[model samples]
Target: MKAYFTYSCILLVFVLQACQSNRKTETKNGGIVKYKITGKVDFNDGMQVYLQNYDNELQQFQKTTVKDGEFILEGELVSDGIYNLIVKTDYKDKDTGKKSFRITYPVFLENNCDYEFKVQKYRDGNVIQAAEIITNSEASNNLFVFEKEVAKVKQTWDTRREALSNEAAQLKASLMTIGKGEDSKYNYAIDRMREAGKESQELAKKNPREEVSSLFVNKPEHRTSLITPYLFKYITINENNYARYWTVLDSLDASIQQHPLTIAAKAKVERVKNFYEQMPVFPSITPRNIKGDSLDISKFRDSKLLIIALWSSRDRFSKMDIPTLLNKEPQLKNLGVSVIYLSVEKKFEEWETGNKSLGLGLNSYLLNVTDKDFIVNNYNVSSFPTYIWVEPKSLKIKELRGGDPATPDFLSAIKKAL
Candidate 1:
């Protein structure tokens, strides 16, 4: 069986905001799998329907139109898993000539599966209503039963998803518009943000995989919407982290450090307020690739900036942080910074699996177990997913993530270097 992987996972963990990791649909021997879904809706003709999967991303599977209260959706299941079954239509009333209405349901799917869904006709003031979806797939049927059982229970984050996501988007918008509100660029940015916010809210209801959003969504939140404050803290604090409290703390922007939500995150770390003013010289060492081939750091000295990310597959932060950084690869490349992932996993088998599972292990390599002690000691590698920014020529090393936010991060350092 071949299982393609998505960066989002269906686990009880979240990324910076809500993204996580998950594996994509699978097929045996890479053979194509098709799915057919026929359904009846109480909704009138011209109704619109869509199928999508939420994995920190709203992945559109298929889109079709409804005719005369019935619809048919048949497509190649790029991979088999649960997807969001969305129903939308336009209604007209005396008060308003036309209004739009939409609702979503979670549906389970697999290869060669035939499913049926019925949206019983009912209306409240031009608004169609359906309490639960009627489906044919047993897995989907069981899921509907589970959703009904928990229908009345509202999670704390369930209410907070919209608010926090809004706040985060607003904060980002404020950052870009701080002194450029009158600029056309700022205006365009705000418009896009509004669209993203609206999409995020809708995905939150439709995606059962996690907290889905249109804008910058996090993983755990994407795979599963169970991102309570407690879980947030647990994902960040419960891991085997070894970096200094001040290291990450100082790396954040002054504004972010003081943000109301981040203030709580700030309280957990220990920091050395004033560390060395200069970047420390990196200790020379040999690195190895995934196939246990040797590497010479000298060959990379000509590169403007190099990032050696030390992480482990078993670490939670690695699972989340790796994907996030990889997503920013284009920006990093524009700055002439090259990234190398060095896994310190105990077993090579697990390292290989983790690399595939995370799906962002493009330039990943394995740290020599025999060389672990010396590297760990000199590099200040006390945590999982530590990024070491090296100026190979000068051999100066700056640990990234949380620093002075002035020149500690890769972007800032690249700017200063250039």
Candidate 2:
């Protein structure tokens, strides 16, 4: 009997040990991110929090409802990447009834790690803006540090630019009043601007391996404009330059190099290469009209100057511009420009509905091409309601206009282009 009791106790101990071991393994292997928030704001049960992964074209978002100011998000990340936290709150206004406000924060997420964030909000009238991140992971700390440093540089640069602008303005005024040659003042301003730019470049070059370098490579503003000039100045495939420009990219971490921002940079480089190699002309496309008839864009090439409006049903600007386009049809025709509204709707039903409702008495066509990428890439259509003016004879793009076409400036630009 004594032997049997001892055996039973031993069996229970083994089972308990196995259960604890399994729990520990699951916690370690499973990519679970737990978050705790403590702040002055009132927390209600079931408040929602969202995590969005950064992407070049579209962001992937995940949501979880907060419970007692804490939430555990479960997902497996392939690699460490930047993520955004978004929280939205609705407040009932005494007069307006209800108003919604959003607060956002950027954080770095590593695979299989936990994070805690403290939300810091500052009052800006009725709306609240996220001011800072009090506590976060090491990666997040590094990213913020880089951002703060960049902000300081931008502030100093702006101050110097403003001072130069003031000096230039004064010089120009004196030249206008006192008659001629004050070109030296303008030259001095230009030289100062150049020097400031050099300083900024040197600052970035000083920390090429820092995680913040990813910001310079990936951030839209930096990659598109701020950093491109410096990069192009050094990068060459020729043997003489030693490919120093390419080495700047090579020095970055592999993860940063494979980031979406890096991908966008590569695309930009390819575009520049293609621009030099290919002729500047619009690609021929055959799409269907609302009445199910095929309309070849090439048919309009030699007939008259075509003003192609690329729009979608869901875009508010596109919907608003439809009426504007219809209103301006007579004027456009008078100027020898024919308008064609191309709907890039993904669904046939939505396109049909929009065509019937919004495109009444307009030359409207649905983008019926199967290869959507080809259309977007060839035309360089980044957003909806994009207007392109094509020359009648050469079939080359004369001008590209974005935003509301109904604006006076837009109409004036069209006339000027013609």
- After superposition on all C-alphas, the RMSD of every candidate to the true structure, in Å, is 21.0, 16.5
Index of the highest-lDDT prediction: 2
TM-score of 2: 0.37
Q: Estimated TM-score per prediction?
A: 0.34, 0.37
**lDDT of each model, Cα atoms only?**
0.57, 0.58
| Tens-digit lDDT string for candidate 1 (1-418) | 1232333442323552232122121112222457777877654577777887744335787788878878898788654345687777766554654457887877766443457766555665435576455543334554564455344233543665666576657757676545744666666666767766766665465533222111111322222211111112332331133143334434543323333224443454322222233334665666656665666767777778777777888899888778777776688778777777778888889988998887854377777766666568755678887777776687665444322222336455456545
Tens-digit per-residue lDDT, 350-389, candidate 2:
9888887784533677776663566577667788888877
Off by over 4 Å in 1: 1-31, 56-59, 91-99, 145-373, 377-418
Alpha-carbon lDDT of model 1: 0.57
Clashing pairs in 2: none
